[model samples]
Target: MALYKHSAYVKTSTSDEFDKVYSPGASTPHSGIYRCEGCANEIAANQGNPLPPQNHHQHTSAQGSIRWRMIVYAQ
Candidate 1:
């Protein structure tokens, strides 16, 4: 999970983009901390840049495929 020292810098949003998921190597829709759905690994990505490639990490059979979900939005 993403951590912060000051709550004043963070605010909640109602944007639908927060609920969307992106595939590996896909163009990032927003800049923020993205968590891997399968492994819970987090990565900082920038908007318009491609996410980590397929071989970025390895997972077990139980972990499933590499899928990314935005957990924190860096406005």
Candidate 2:
């Protein structure tokens, strides 16, 4: 099974632009948006921890891991 994760910064966005862009599915939580440091994209609202897909390569550091995931916007 594929582990799916949402962005955190998107959940923190004060503006509704993220919500307008992503238009997360009904199953998606209606939270704030998290800013993705990796892609410079706005995380969708109400999603989980907006991390990259498990199969993708993520950025790792000695201290811990950075949330470097791709932003999926509603088209």
Top candidate, metric TM-score? 1
Q: Pairing residues by index, what is the TM-score of model 2?
A: 0.25
User: Can you write out model 1's per-residue Cα lDDT over 18-63, one digit (the tens) per residue?
Assistant: 7988899999888999999999999999999999987899999999
Per-residue lDDT over 1-75 for candidate 2, one digit per residue giving the tens place of the 0 to 100 score: 112476642233244443432221223333433344543444444445433343333444642332332233332
Residue 19 accuracy (lDDT) in model 2 = 40
User: Relative to the unseen true structure, what is the C-alpha lDDT of residue 45 in candidate 1, on a scale of 0 to 100?
Assistant: 97
**Model 1 CA deviation exceeding 4 Å by range:** none
Q: Lowest summed lDDT over 10 consecutive residues: which window, candidate 2?
A: 21-30
How does candidate 1 score on lDDT?
0.91
The lDDT of each candidate is 0.91, 0.36
RMSD to true structure for each model, in Å: 0.9, 11.9
